[model samples]
Target: MDIRQYIDSTYLKTPAMAGTTIKENNEVVRSLVNEAVANGYKLVMVRPEMVAFVKRLLCVEKSKVLIGTVIDFPEGEGMLFKKLDEANKSIYDGADELDFVIDYKAFKRRDFEKVKTDVIECTRLCLDHKKIAKWIIEVAALSDKEIISITALVKNVVLTYFSESDYFNVFVKSSTGFYKTESGKPNGATIHSVKLMLENSFPLPVKAAGGIRNYEDAVQMIRLGVKRIGTSSASEIIAGEQVSDEY
Candidate 1:
């Protein structure tokens, strides 16, 4: 399979997260954007602030690499309006795809209704703007049962509110790749969790994000039917080498 099309070449770490200056962090973003242009990546996932820059750069190069940005980021705890505002701004800033971290904390609090509304309204905003929308369920933060339920929840919400034609534009993604875990546990996609997501979010597509560190892992996820693979190590993976697995 041509894994390049399925790869969402990602670089979402902020200056603080990367322990670098703002200029230095932005240089990395710019380089990633340039690399995407050179390598024919399907998309480049950047922070909201970098969307316009990436867009202009791609436009200059006449590159078809789609721009994706995260909404409410590693913490999906923002209120519904806050999430929508972030997403709207990202779209306005030239983001072709918005990966919204679901309000999974609310779901864990048993606030299923809030989660439903958040998903529906946020997705509506994306469709209205003619942009792709992805829901990051943060698999590392969820139990197996929660993974199943949340994936199905996103599928139902999308199917109920969006037409069948829009199904491909929406995806239920696996994680943020930034979650902290006890005992050095994986904070990204695992085969088991991905399988659960695939089983539950079928027909709506699944994006296995977070811990895809090598070509083998990406291929495995694709074989399991995930439509997209989000990772910060796209180059190393394509090179058949080990990736340090930064987000």
Candidate 2:
């Protein structure tokens, strides 16, 4: 596999999040965008505010690197309208794909109705705009049964509301790369979690994000059927090396 094509070259940390100065953070985002464009990675994931800036960079270079931004990010508890507003703004800012963090907390609370509405609205927004949509179901926060249930929930939502032609554009993404967990447990994508997602969300591709720090792990995800990988370690992975930066 040409692993580069499967990468969602990512850097979602803000200045405060990374404890860096704003200039430093901008440089990091710029460098990541340039590197992704140079490497021809499938996409470059960034914060919603940076989507337009990244789009301008790609436009200047005439690059094909798709621009992806998160909606309602690490926390998916934003009111439905808030999430839609954020997604609409990002889409207007030239995002090619929007990875919306599903209201997993609601799902955990057994509010499947809320989860269904979240999926229906966000997924439809993306599909209507002819852009890729990914639903991030923060796996670290859920149990095995919850993971299975949530994945199936997304699959059913898309398959039920959207046409088959739209299936490929909708994805059940694994994490936001920003989920907090107790005791430093794996807070990002795990084989077990991703496996459940793939088994349940088949046909709608899965994008495994967060905590995937090495080439072996990236390839393993692909081998297990993930259509995309969102990671901060794309360069190291391309160089076939492992690094210890948790996304």
Candidate 3:
């Protein structure tokens, strides 16, 4: 299936958590970008600040691996303008795809309008800039019904505002890989959650993120019709190795 093409090799750790210095963290991102290019992975997902650095590195090396960054990150409680600002900067800094963490807090609170507006603005910004947009609904934090409703909500907004050709450009992604559950449960992509997302967001592409550790799991996601799989285990999966990392 040329799994490399559907994999987004990702590293979204903060500088402090990732390294002691900016140089050290950037070196990590650079290594990831280099590895992605060499391995023919589809993209390298990094923090927003690292987008420009990755872009410059790719330019110098003449690599075609896409640069993707997260917006609103693990927490989607930021104000709309702030999220948009982050998105704009990432795009200006050469991010080709933006994975936005939608305001699930608002959705859970039954503030559907707020949630819808948040998604619409961020997605429209990506559309205006001709960049890929994926909404990270943080499935692990929600119930089955919540997942279905939110996925459908995102689909409705995209179809309402965009053309058919642009549907694939917008995706309903599974998780942010950083959400904490009260029970300390696994807070990443699961087959059941992904199945719900796919069934609800049919025309819009679905990206299964988090908890996808091996090639077999990735292949299963593809079989479920996921367009992308986001994980730090991309290299391991591609090489047919199993790792114990949760990203």
Candidate 1 lDDT at 87 equals: 87
The TM-scores of all predictions, comma-separated, are 0.97, 0.97, 0.97
| Candidate 1 residue runs with Cα over 4 Å from true position | none
**TM-score between candidate 2 and the true structure:** 0.97
Q: Total clashes, candidate 2? A: 0
**Per-residue C-alpha lDDT of model 3 across residues 1-247, encoded as one tens digit per residue:** 6799998999988777765588888788888988998998899999998899999999998988999999998888999999999999999999999999999989999999999998888988999999999999999889999999999999999889788988999999999888877776768888999999999998999999998888899999999999999998788888888877776
TM match of model 3 to true structure: 0.97
- The digit string of per-residue lDDT tens for model 2 on 178-241 reads 7678897998899989999999998899999887888889989999999999999899989988
- Positional deviation of 188 in candidate 2, in angstroms? 1.0
**Clash tally, candidates in order:** 0, 0, 0
RMSD of 1: 1.0
**Candidate number with the higher lDDT (2 or 3):** 3
Report the C-alpha lDDT of model 1 over 1-247, residue by residue, as the tens digit: 6799998999988899789999999899989988888889999999888998889989999889999999998889999999988888888888999999998899999999999999999999999988999999999999999999999999999889889999998999989988988998888889999999988998899999987888998999999999899988888899998887744
Among all windows of 10 consecutive residues in model 2, the one with the lowest summed lDDT is 175-184
Against the hidden true structure, what lDDT does model 2 obtain?
A: 0.90
